[model samples]
Target: MSVFRYTLLASVVLPAALSTVPALAQQAPFPADAGESDGADTIIVTGRVQRLYRAEQTTVGKAAEDPMNIPQSVQVINSELFTDQGARDATDIYRNISGVSFFSYAGVTFRGFRQDQSFYDGQRGNPFIGFSVPQLFNIERVEVLKGPAGLFFGPGSPGGIINYVSKTPSDTSSLRMVATGGNYDRVGISAEATGPVDADGIITYRVGGFYEAMDPYRRNTTNKAKIADGAIAIRTNEGGKLTLQATIYDNYLRANRLRGVLVDDAGNFLTDIRWNANEPTDFLHLKSQAYQARYETSVGDRVTFDAGVRYFDAREAQKYHEPRGLDPANPDLVRREFRDQIRPVHGLSFMTNATARVDLLGMEHKFQAGADWYDEKNVLDSRILRTGVTSLSLSNPVYGGAAEGDAARAALLPFTTTDTRTKRQGVYLQDQISLTRSLLLVGGVRYDHFEDKVTTSTGGAVSNRSSYRDGDVTLRTGLIFKPLPDISTYVSWSQSFEPQAAASQDANAGGPFAPVTGNQVEGGVKTQLFEGRLQANLAAYRIVRRNILQVDPSLPPVNGVDQLAPIGEVTSKGFEVDLAADITPDWVLLVNYGYNDTRITGTVAGQAITNAVGDRFANAPRHKVGFWTRYQFPVLDAAFAFGGEHVSSRISLSGQSVQPYTIFDASITKGLGFAELLLRVDNIFDKVYAASGFSAQSGHFPGEPRTFLAELRVRF
Candidate 1:
């Protein structure tokens, strides 16, 4: 069957499934019995259920407000949730969210847009090109705003935005220590401490750090990383504050990168056969340092102002092997070559916002204005060693073929050295009007300016220089209605733009390509059920994107890649539902489901494109589901948690099909005075599957096998 058929099936089935849940709740016997607020249950559940999948307030829109009133699809993952799940990277947390997935060379796919960029404290951060994953030890919480959020985040993927909030100092002093040892010979230690720096309570400080090393499940793979983060704040009695924060990250991975097994036509990867398609000497190193300063003060009772500045620097070096193709004479033999490269990037950002409340036309209104600017520079130095390990047999593999040393390395002087610089600026204004006692209107508009410069050199001689510039205005508006204090229903429309960094294939055209534009219309309902202990949200949305990059199929390959053109349009529509409940004081449940359908809608009339209209985007599964539940026994001072995830079949870049797969995980935790012990197991069923892959490439990444981890945590 085709993707459209499956999407149609889901569209019919999911709504029907949702309609029955409320009836089932009415007949169920648990919420009435467990909803009672006993002293014991309150003490135990308060530390667990209240913190899961919930945030009191967020600054995703430059305004702090309850997520239920945001008029969009938003999900918050606090430290407690990720800590319990043993999350280390984006993949771990995205699994619990609807309509989010990972892919190789694509970074992360949200909705139908490939998002390679993420934000820190509402500002742009370093891009993740699938080479290095960010650390989470110092993160206080993560907020994900779904759909077109360009009004606040400027140019980015239309799918949504992700913001990472760092931990800061508090009045109460606390310290925590954690030691962990897990499968794959993993062991690590981490520490976090925060306290007041002065007796008068005017100064406070916080520090957090972690170190870990492990041998991964993949053969000949080893990894190690170290991170440190610190912050300090000074406060005045008048509610004015000044803060400074800094962080350092160093990471190294010596393993087979971009190496995976080949799948059959049916998308079945042989479980017993596994080999590293790259040389054992392959490795990657990344180091970064960042600092920020922020100040906030109130001019009067109804007005406030805030400002911040941030700077970041990073360096990367890697040597790996990239796959070519299978030998024509031997289907089981795969061809590979060596790649050596280095990149150094640095950037600075400045932002400010002011908010005020006023009464006009017999109603009160809140208004906000903000502006932000960022400048970044990047340098890429690349080289190639073509004579390394060439082929590897799928059925059988042996070591000691190619060794790592300067003697075996050779530089390709013909390769171009590129230096790129980018500047982005945006100014936005927002207003919240209370139309009536239970009705509210929210709206915002942003004007953005973007420009880029590229300089290329060959063998120490300058070859070419190019510059491009563009600007756009984005808009957002929403309406929210509240029949009850805890129930909210809203509808929203938003716009987004993303500037293309590469030049167009048509040299005769005026200049670089125009930015891709996106717009979305969404409606949703959010409510607190069962006396505010259970939260449920349901949303439906449709997004249309124009000026998408497409390649001309009639033209021959250029340097093993096709020439690009920008004359494509695509549409993505989906329904999402999320539920988190403390269904009895001791029982917690989390469930999320997404039904997504994405397809190319338009292309040049006569020019053939690789992706035809009505074809689904590569690696975007139409169906995704997740379920997790936990139960705590107060008497035994213990808790048990289990969850499983499922994804439907996906289409690859080359139009190959990938079969659907599922995985399960479970964990147990016991409290011992000021310390706690946790035992967790992932991939409990030992199912063999592909986490992700490139359709046109030979890299079919195999999922990990059954693994176990044990952690001991203490607090003082």
Candidate 2:
């Protein structure tokens, strides 16, 4: 039998066999009624003592609903999971999520789509950039909602969205600190504190931050970053609350490489090398800051309103040498190019929401209405100073050869500049209706209007200006049935829309292209078995995306660009199973498996864009699996965890194949009187592989080698 079959069987049979075991105090019992508010009922699962995988409530749907009550796939990763896995960013956590892949700076891949946008406290005001990895020191938890969420998050990729909930102020005094040291000359320190500010206990505050520096695994590569976050919460006399939060982050990187070694036609790695592709003098610097203010109040016992405003500003500057291609004269020598760029961006958002719960016609209904507006402006100045002639040896490379100082910087002058602005406004309404004691229905609709404009300046002259506008409507509906209090079966249908800026300049007689539309149909089953200690979920879904821009093969190139037409469609279907269990007081288990088949089903007649209709989506693996287990030793007061990740062969956009590889990892943590020590090792097998990529030159990013870290955490 295949590994997938065995995993599926284990996922189906483990809960049944474990149900006979006695319950433990690791996880709290589920609430008896679903109508209760999630104020004090919300459970925060951490790794300090007993850590459970299950989460009670999530805001993925723009509402605090029970995970079992929702008719969709929702995965929650608590702080405990973060600490055990040593997850500092999305890349660290992607291994545990089935069907999620990382492609370097291309962002994250989910459900056969590449997703780069994220939601912070359910707000969109930041970019998912390579230098701007999310800082987890101030994060409470991360909720991942799979499938199209346009009705709640507005226009976005059909792959779904990642929501990060920031840590908030508490009414109790607490302080914690962590110091870490690891291979590659890594060292870091982080601290957090929260407490009441006044005698009445009506006001509270939280302050936390982290500073980390590392000499990366690749030769001549280094990274350093610092983040600070603060929040204040005020309780009004009339049963209302206000929160103000701010954050600042600065990151610097030297000799950061974007791609790796080249591969031959047979997908054989030509270079047995691991070093920075960039020159030693290259550097990337980024700085960003954000502020948010929100107020929430209750009008009556059943009605509540919330309003918020957020602003973010960021700047990035980078000077690097990029790999171009192999030299025609000698394939052993790789050509290189030099680039210098600077970008500054600003974003603002405003939102308000009202929710009410009422009993009508012998049933209960929860209604919500909200409106949001966002605008972002960006400026880019870039130049390519040199190309082709510069080269590097494939087998061995020596640094410090490239010219540095003002001479090199002066060569990148007279940069081309671009200014772009985008704005979006959306309004939505949703209702969760209880049709019967065991049946629930959810439905929502949203309308979005968006506009984008771009202007370019070349050679100190205003060159061109282009603008586009469009409007779209999205819908979401689901049905959930429960035969047992701990079991739920659900089916859902949803739609998403995203405006296309690429087709705005197409020289075609078909008129302006329409926005891309995506629809999905999904069915799933969720169960809380083993006395609420084990949570299992199985989901199957099919999604179709239409109105994709395809090149017109029938028409010759016009002005060096092929004519475009919006007559393409893509489809993705998959099955996913996830299991999380705290089998006993000392044993914990987490498992996930996914099988995805994504293909381009239709396109303009007799036209192909390198990727054909029958080919699977680039960088999307057909099979993925992850398994992890941890056991705590009573006498030693320590926990040990081991896990492995697997991925099947993947094809790139140019049809270059990426061989499948599996990696193993392990970690151990011991608790003392006031401090906890942890040791973690990744890629324990020391297997050399490529994680994911697109091409031989600009892709084929190499995976990290065997790495280890030791950390000490203290709490007061």
Candidate 3:
């Protein structure tokens, strides 16, 4: 079953766990329990969506029909939810996932982790969020495998990894279209079709594309993207099959980089903003193109192989005055940052899996051995625009797009800039040996070698340069026990490693790469209640990393936030729990919590190098929670959705108590013949607060007020 339908099954598991959803729904919109649909037990519950039916899953690798079960905390965003939710981009797909929030400051957030460190399919899809290009649209479903995934992914984040699955062609010939319009003048249209290439059924093809546009509250109101993707598969009579898929994406953006707000003499934060209240030519612009190619094949009955390659290119430029209060070094517009970048990535990931039955031991074994390689080349040219000192306020939210009449033009500086390119190579072997009818064992080890090199933006300069040894090995072990047909529990542990780029000063001093980092994790998972319809994965994990790297700004002259700080040592640890239930056939519920004990375990600055008595991590809140639910109106054959999301209160500017906040949302959708209609209202009642952790110049601003969207889809 697709991951989505599996999540549908997750919705069914709830009835046996909580029978009090109706009362909760009637009260607060963001009720701790989440939604109001806790009544119905007729939904036929099955396996969770481990495999989502969409364009991308086919890109990860070929899965064996009866392959050994992988022990990991995996979640899927299925297509059924896709059409129902009208998800325009990768960010929207996780609307109901708890503790997972999208931070425009960087990228998508999981628990307290950012998307920059995650993976795409099983490749090196991770990139710095602000500049990372997006490749989504005709996606199949998104797969999230939690825990230290160094073996599965390359390096960077030790928090976990996320993969986006693309769509693939099938033997069925059919076409589907989806179109929608909503608040913020948002509109989107997408079409897809699958058909057989030959009457003999040897070849098949699937093609899909989409166009979308919207106006947000950010500086640049116009946001749009266009995508085209297709896949082809060939089946042979000898029990072998091959599938290949290709995709291209285009994006257009014009938005003021909403920096932080400015605090006044009285401590009041300002909102009205502009490129430069003193300059009229400031502008923001960026456009990109991305392409992906994948291939997969299955041999005989005991072995399978999958591989893929991807490339991306973008021409991006942005001109924005550094915000006043936000930049501690200089509040005034001493200089501005103008940037241009063209980034392309080339990488390949493939694996082979085989099963063997041992007669002497009377046991069956599934052995999976695979190799992986990745490389990324980043080209950047940034120009600093200087214009002495400009006018007031970068924090004030400027709504009218005002004009500053007699302002001077910013003078351009001819300084060339550049960055170091990164590359990684890895290989692994895993074995799952089934010992008894009720027990199974899994174990594996992996090794990776990574290299980074720096260069000048203009090719006029070169250096044998700074480098570091980024090679390490890790192992994974797990045990599964199924005493009952409906009850299964497993305990698993995995190890991962990462080596960060050198510090700026070190680089300037001809410094070399830093020490390689390592993280070890262990946790137990449980899939319980009601014939496997309900699943609650409770995991207690401690991520230990050595040679921890952190930027510090505590050096005498610098007591505030610094863009240029020294790299120090640190260790972050946390715990996570997620529960999904079908509750009843007519009602569904989802709830999750994350407790991250993130601290500057070690820093050279002694007592207050990083965490002060009141200082919190940049964007992480110790406590994170989210809940969502949908209940079907049996009489109308439609579902009504409602839920609330929240983050506990925390400090923003080293001081100030910006209270904790929560927002509620609701919607309903009905399936009618070949067409389905959906209606949703977000931020119901318009509770205002920063959805992003960033607060107002004062303390906090209201989140997106009441907003709604209506959509429809058709298939033949």
The lDDT leader among the candidates is 2
lDDT of 2 by residue, 1-716 (tens): 24422332332233334333335324443334322112333222123333465578997876667998888898988766787777887678887787678755637778888778888888888743444567677778889999999988899988788898888899877777899877777899999999999998899999998998998876677899889999999997586889999998888888873566677645567876475567677888888888999888987778888888989999988887777767799987777777788899989999888889989999899899999999999889888766333587777876665545422754646888998898999999998899997999999999999988888897779887777887899999999999988999999999998888733554443436778899999999999886667889999999999988777777777667667777788899999999988766667889999889988888866666334324567778888899887765545556667788998888765568778889987776766655777777778768888787567675476788877777788766
RMSD of candidate 3 to the truth, in angstroms, is: 8.3
In the range 164-187, model 3's lDDT, one tens digit per residue, is 666778776777777867766778
Among these predictions, the greatest TM-score belongs to 2
Q: Candidate 1, residues 498-532: lDDT per residue as tens digits? A: 88764452343323577889999999999887667
- Once model 3 is optimally superposed onto the true structure by TM-score, how far is the C-alpha of residue 113 displaced, in angstroms? 4.5
Task: List the candidate 2 regions with Cα displacement exceeding 4 Å.
Answer: 1-49, 127-131, 237-239, 299-301, 403-412, 502-509, 554-562, 605-614
Global lDDT of model 1: 0.75
- For model 3, state the Cα shift of residue 572 in Å: 3.8
Indicate whether candidate 1 or candidate 3 has the larger TM-score: 1
Candidate 2: C-alpha lDDT = 0.78
Clashing residue pairs in all predictions, respectively, total 0, 0, 43
